[model samples]
Target chain A: MNDKLVTVLADVFGLRREQIVPQLTKDDVGNWDSLKQMDLVVSLEREFGVELEIADIITMTSVEKINRILKAKGVDLEA
Target chain B: MKLDGAVSLITGGSKGLGLAIAHRLRAEGARVIVADIDNVALEALPDVFDRRSLDVTQPDEAKSTVEAIAAMYGRIDVLVNNAGVIYSEPLVNLMNPDGMMHSYDRFRQCLRVNLDSVFIMTSAVVEQMVLRRTKGVVINISSISARGNEGQTAYSAAKAAVNAMTVTWSKELGRLGIRCNAVAPGFVDTPSTRAALNETIIKHIEGLTPLRRLGRAEEIAQAVVAAIANDFLNGTILDVNGGVTI
Candidate 1:
């Protein structure tokens, strides 16, 4: 689950492996914007088999927040 | 619109491609608002339609026009940016003071209407759509001129930018379920084309097109509808050029 979460974050944000951590948010990265915010949602959906509602997308701003939210949403995240 | 029972706003919708699209959407039961710069054309607007006089080239005008449509109706489900104009001016002689000298005034006017108006309208409507979380669709009417028609340098450059904006907005607002796409039409026999176009030049285009004929406005309108209906088909371009631009 940790590995999969890291992969989804890196792909959407174009981040390096080390750059990805559970605590990262918009403040921790420069690529985050309104557009990339959408991109992150799409990437997460494609990567994790989780369809995020717009409200969930807004609330799941940081990597740690996304992981916690996905677990609640029934995404295995391990696969 | 939501395919049915939704509100739509079409720029340049008094006639030609815009009118055709409005008709098609209305046939499918979407409420339509048609805006254009010509009052004469607005008089000829279809029955039971919401028509307005709008020069979308002005930012405030576009904002006010779109906001009014939304307020009068309930929400804007579809936005079709189908307004544009063009003149034949090769880059080399576009500065000609006489016969060869292209009209700079006309070129600037074309960009203002075709390109800048698009930005204003999209910005205005999308902000509302975003706030409402409307998950709307935006279709910009582009031309094969974006593929580099020699006599339409200004048109080509402006439409290329339209294409760029489409992709940018698609990325910008996708999470809200808003999709952005463009439809690039080939030479179509509309009032504007009939006025200044030459048969010989058209013949040359037919020679280039595998279909060997000018496209119709309805054909372009069909492409626009397809883009609007397909939710997953976002950030892409649909060309109805009859194999001309391949």
Candidate 2:
């Protein structure tokens, strides 16, 4: 699950898969600016096939965190 | 260097400044939509308008109209909030100067159309922009009166708020290269201007303006194109008043 989340993050940020890790925080990434953050939100929504509300946007900080939050939001990540 | 083939949406487009801007942008090759309330005015709208009638002050109206546009056009590249109303009277002296004057309902109408509609329209479109990660431009048509207009209390306050929004939204949307800006025009000499103001007053305005004349609609349209073209010109409120506000 975490590896898949990393792949999603890498693709969203326009970075190589090897450049991202499960522990990658936004500050560590150069492309994770506000515009890119919004882009990340969109990419995640499309990846998980889930729609995020305003509050959910605040909670998605790291790859692991997004995966956890998506699961809690009833996304079937295993599939 | 161009907005050619891009999807552009202009609110309250169909008359006056908005219509002129649509004409200008379309001539530059943008696919445009003019959203307005007057059905007849919409008919005469330039071949570019791709008309959409909507009272942008209402949330449902904004949401449905934008979604419909996105469905039809695929994406929105530019949004111009040009639909607004105003009252040409002092806020306190509502009892009529000498009778035979209009009531003070100007405040309500002005606030509803000028201020409320901008919030609804931006909210509806920003969501789609965020989703698409689209680098879009939002041009909020403010007035030079936003700094301070004696007779136009509501209009001034609403435009001031629009200026504030230009800053806040620029901060919010900057990361994705989504630029937000405003153009504040002073004493523009549109057809409506000739109808609204007397000759003496218009002369006074022209005399006071450093440019010695009222501005034209196409002048403001030129500023709009500049903002959209130059990438570094984000979060700015361009004053196109011929140095009057200075």
Candidate 3:
């Protein structure tokens, strides 16, 4: 799951895998704005094969938050 | 992307253009839902089509209705924002003796129904599409009047805005695999138009148009279905006006 999340972040934000950290918030990332947030949402949904609520999308600012939200949506992070 | 077994919601589908679109889409194998504020017309739809009573202008109702449909069908594959009203009063009626000025209420009501409702309903459905990663199509029913029409200031403005937003949404949502397009029909021969428009006015419009006659609702509906079927036809307001705007 972490590897997939890193790939999605790297692909969607055009960031290096090393740049993606669990604590990396939108504020820390230069390219991660609201519009990019939506891209992230789409990428995450497609990658994880899980639907995400708009509320969850809005709150998903960091990798940690995304991990929790994906788990909440029944996506097995350990898989 | 195929219409077969896809779920579609068309607002204002109780009669006229909306009903025609509902029929056309259903015939193409879509599971159709016709939503309108008129309960009577809703009740009269055939058993093949699902019917829902809704006032699309209310945000809460829009949210709840979209949620209900998503719950039932698992996704909304198509959304036709067709609910709207037109008021043909001039910006100022100087001939009035009672001194009833062009009221704000009239203009606001037109915008509320025509413009605001589209935004509200589209947002609700697009959110669900975003969540489910559904490649949805949004068809906004626009009119030739969007370019300009005499004494139809409010209606014209609202439809023009719809066209603008259709383009905007197409750009914004295209990357998500969702496409937004519009069908701007010319004056159509419907029961309401036949009753409300006089012979002289109708004749003048017909003469002005290249086709020399008003369009049919079925023709407009066919254009809508075609728009949805075409994968690359996004951000375009397909003017189904038969060269009238020319």
Cα lDDT of model 3 by residue, B149-211, tens digit = 766788898999999999999999999999999999888998767765656567767888988
Give residue B127's lDDT in candidate 3 (0 to 100): 96
Would candidate 2 be rated incorrect, acceptable, medium or high by CAPRI criteria? incorrect
TM (B chain), model 2: 0.93
Per-model C-alpha lDDT, please? 0.81, 0.80, 0.87
DockQ for each model:
0.01, 0.01, 0.01
Ranking by lDDT: 3, 1, 2
Q: Write the per-residue lDDT of candidate 2 for residues B1-246, one digit (tens) a residue.
A: 259987899997898888888988898899999999888999876564699878888899799889888878877889999998655555433222243233457667788888888889998888787777778999999998899776567878889999999989999998987889999888887766777565656776787898899999999999988888787888899999988852
Model 2 chain B: which ten-residue window has the lowest total lDDT? B93-102
Better of 1 and 3 by lDDT: 3
**Candidate 3 residue runs with Cα over 4 Å from true position:** A1-79
Candidate 3: Cα lDDT at B3: 88
lDDT of 1 by residue, B98-136 (tens): 444456887787788779989988998897787677889
Candidate 3: tens digits of C-alpha lDDT, residues A1-79:
3788889988887678998888878667654545466678889888989988766776788888988899888888776
